[model samples]
Target: MLDWLIIGGGIHGTHAALRLTAQAGVAADRVRLLDPQPSLLARWTQCTGNVQMPFLRSPVVHHIGLSAFELFEFSRTPEGKRFAAFAPPYDRPAYALFQAHCHHLLTQHRLPELHIQSKAVGLHRMGERGWRVETPAGGLDARRVVLALGLSDQPAYPAWTAALASSGAPVRHVFDPNFRAAELGDWQQAVVFGGGISAAQLALALAARQPGTVTLLLPHPLRIHQFDSDPGWLGPKYMRAFEAERSLDRRRRMIREARHRGSVPKDVAQNLRLAAQRRELRLCEAQVLDAQPTDAHRIQLHLSPGDSLETDCLLLATGFDGRRPGGAWLDAAVATYELPIAPCGYPVVSRALRWARGLYVMGPLAELELGPTARNIAGARKAADRLAQVAERRRTGHQVTAA
Candidate 1:
């Protein structure tokens, strides 16, 4: 049996595995990261590349490495200084620089050897032994399991997209794993939906490629916020009050309110405005009420305020679904194991992100405990810190492990 089996080899899972081996003294051979992708952070790379995002919204310090300042220190290295590493305001690292730093860490620690390219379909307790995770290849036994699943698998499509697709219109979500921006085909006009950073970046990219041929349709005026949530949520400034709250419903509300949903950063917003002024991109502020295929190659989108648009391609940068991830397999596990969930159907995990005995959660699952930043890179670091403490206590012969 493995010492730790992490399901999902994205940012959260990679960070968890690194923390276990590097800080908790767990043998790298004993820890495994299970993901459907062939490599770690593949989905992250794909999604960011699809949008042509230049820099990350997160700061340079928020990375998957063992130390908080590792990325910052890397900036001073010869390789890191090759390109534009950090942006202004908050020193947000360029996407290329961030990925390079992550690659360095993964290679230095040999974390890729711990990866198992398989999807975890089922999970069940093994009584006193530990837990068994069911995959297509077979079942793997582990003393502990961390569900580090991300929201990438659950892309949120607008309601009108289904009908438009059925009518033979070209509509795609930017975050779809199979949706390649390079294969978007030659189109006279393209409509990029959503008002968030991804939509803005994608619109800018499309406009730059084909000036005066791209339109950004925003449901509302573009909201400008540097980060998704206030930086206070990362530390005890906002987290202290959040942790003191005993009500999960209230906590959910707090998270929703704290998140700056469908918003862009100041830099991105500024760039978008400049593109609009240059006539390279057209910005429209109105909700898409419905859409219909005007012909085989054209779609007429009915917008709010009695306006309509005809376009050859429609790209949705709409984010992921708000539903709990892991689908029916996880629902079955939750029912069979009787794991405690909040009223919103999210995991009610402990401070260490433990949901059940020997079972932990990260990403969206740990939101209630980690606060609004639970789905970001900083949350992964926070989770690693908590899990490291647990692993250290376990190493020292502590037995209080029940959640």
Candidate 2:
């Protein structure tokens, strides 16, 4: 049996594994990262590439490394100094630089050897022994398990997209793992549906390629925010009050209010403005009421303000669904183990991020306990810190359980 098995090899899972091995003194060989992708952060790379995002929204300090200063210190190195490494305002690392730093960490620690390229299909407790995670290859036993699933798997598609897809129109969600933006063949008209940074970046990319033929469809005027949420959420500033709130419903409301949904950064907004001024992109602020396929291999979107638009390609950067991830497999596990979930269906983890006796959570599952930043890189780091403490206690012969 493995000492720790983390399901999902994205940012959260990779961070958790690194923390357990490097900081918590857990044997590297005893922990495993279970994921469907062939490599760690594959989905992140794919999604970011799909949008052609130049830099991350999060600051340079928020990464899957041991120290907050690691990435900054790396920037001083010859290798890290090559690219246009850091952006202004918050020193957000360029995507390429961030990827290179991640590669360095993974190689230095040999974390890739811990990867198991298989999707976890089911999870069940095995009594005193621990837990058993079901995968297509077989079941793997672990003393502890961490569910580090992210929201990317649950791509949000607007209701109107269904009809357009049924009519054989070219409609794709930018975050879809298989959706390759470069593979999109020659198209005279393209429409991107969303208002967030992803939509803005994708619109800018398409506009550069097709110019004047790309339109960004938004439900509201563009709003600019440097980060998705206030930086206060990262530390005790906002978190102290959030942790004191006992009501889960109110906490959920606070999280929703704190997130700057469907907004972009100032730089991205500026680029969009430049694109519009140059006639490279069109911005339309209206709700999509319905959609249909036109006879000429196009899609016609009916707008709420008595307007209509037609395009050869309709791309959705609408973000991910708000539903609890892990799907039926997780639902089954929840039912079987009677894990405590909030009214919103997310796990009610402890301060240490333990969902149960031996099961821990990260990313979306730890949101209620970790606050609004629970799905970002900062949250992953925080969750890993807490979990590392738990591992240390276990190693020192202290029995720890879900609070």
Candidate 3:
């Protein structure tokens, strides 16, 4: 039996494994991280590359490392010197440099050896407080389990998307595994639906790749924000207010109101503006009511307030639905264990991020406990810090300092 079995080898899982061995004094051989991808952050790499994102929206301090200052200190090193600044005020790190820093952490920590490239199909309690994780290869018993499953892999489809499918139109979500940006070759016109950073990035990519016009259909006008949510959420400034809300439903409402939803960075918005000025992009503030496939390999989009658009291809840059993270796996696990889930479909984890028994969770599922930053890289570190403390206390029977 393993000491710890972390599900989902993305940023959260990888960082949790590192914390368990390094800070919590757990044996390296006793911890295992399970993911479907052949390598760590494979889906993240593919999704970022698909839209050709130049820089990360998050700051340099947010990374898969113990110290927040590690990346900043690394910026002064020879290997990290290749990094370039994004813009003023925010000064986001270049995506390549960020990735290089991650590779360095993996090598420094020897994280690759801890990875198990398999999907966790089922999770159930075993003897006493232990867990039995089921996979296609076999079952692995573990003393504890940490669900680090990030929800980025699950692509969400709008209600109108079903009509498009019924009409036999060629439509694809940007996060679909089989949808390749390169496969959109020789298209004369394309339409993108979304108003977030991914939508902005994909529209720019389409404009650059396709020969003809590209239109971006958004339900609301573009709102530019430095980060996904207010920087205040990163600290106790907004978090204190968030914690004061006693009701979970009220907390959910606070999270929604705090987030600058469907917004993009200033740089991304500028790029889209430049593309529009060049006559290669069209920005439409309209809702897609329905869609049907027309003859000649085109799709007819029925917009709100008596508007319509015809395009050769339609792409949904919309992201995944948070209410249902990994769909079946999470549903089955929640149902089997009778986990305490909020009405909004998120887990109501303990202060130490424990879900039930020996099972713990981080990332989006821990939002109610960790606040708005729960899904970002920074939240992974915070969750790791808390979890490491728990593991250390369990191991040494003494008070442990924060990592």
Candidate 4:
């Protein structure tokens, strides 16, 4: 039996394992991280693969290492010196630098084996001691379980997606991992949806491949405006303001306003304009109403400037569902043992993010505990750190003699 069973081995699960073994004094062998991927950080390929972004929206302190400055300290070492310029604490760090810093730490750790290519089917609780996790490999008895699932589990296709899918169309939200962007061929026109940073990056990426062949569709007017995440909410100031509101309705409204609903930062905004100026990209304001297949080879999209359009392909950068992943794991687990699910389909977690019977949650699901940013990388660290402390306490309290 492992001391901790952390599901999802991306940044969240990795942090949980690292903090538990290295910092919290839990034996390394006692920690088990189970993820379906063959390696870590694979999900970022779809999200951040286009242009190498400089300047992370988050600061250096918000990273994967155990200590707050562990990333900074590692950056100065030989493996990390290449990224030292981006490590200046006072300045906003670069994405490439941050990514490199994280990779460097992963290398230093010599890649701990926490089981790869494993998907957790769900979980069941032992009578009192721990939880039982079902994996493709077999069953794992863990003293504590941490749900560190990432954004991939909850890809939020637009509402119209279901209608289109039911209509038996080639249409699909870009979040489908099977839909390979590189597989696209010579097409005269394609539409990339959304107005946020992702929309811009995808438009730029597609245009560079096909050249003057793609258009961007946004539901609203372009602002040439800069919208990084809210700075006030980074710490306690603005966060507490949202927290103080007792009503979930008010809290939801405040969260919406606090996050970037559909906007890009200054740098990304400029990059999109540059991509357009190169005559490879075009941006338009229009809403997508319905999409259906004209044939196996073509799709007709009904648009709501009150018109229609045809496209070779469509990409939806809309984001993910706050609800559970479209998988059997959540529903199966809930049904198997009767777990309490919030009306939103998210697990109602304690302030420490434990679900029921000592099973905990992290990442996007932990948003209610840590606030709106809980889906981001920094929030991953926070979730892992907190869960580690809880797991540590439980493990120490339960050591049994061979007698």
| Residue lDDT tens for model 1, 322-390 | 899999989999999899999999999887789988999999999999999999999999988888888
Q: Assess the local accuracy of residue 69 in candidate 3 as a C-alpha lDDT between 0 and 100.
A: 75
Ranking by TM-score: 1, 2, 3, 4
RMSD of 1: 1.2
Stretches of candidate 2 above 4 Å error?
A: 399-403
Model 3 lDDT vs. the true structure? 0.83
Which pairs clash inside model 4?
55-94, 156-320
Each model's total of backbone clashes: 0, 0, 0, 2
Worst 10 residues of 2 by lDDT: 160-169
Deviating ranges (above 4 Å) for candidate 3: 166-168, 399-403
Cand. 2 Cα-lDDT: 0.91
Q: lDDT of all predictions, in order shown?
A: 0.91, 0.91, 0.83, 0.71
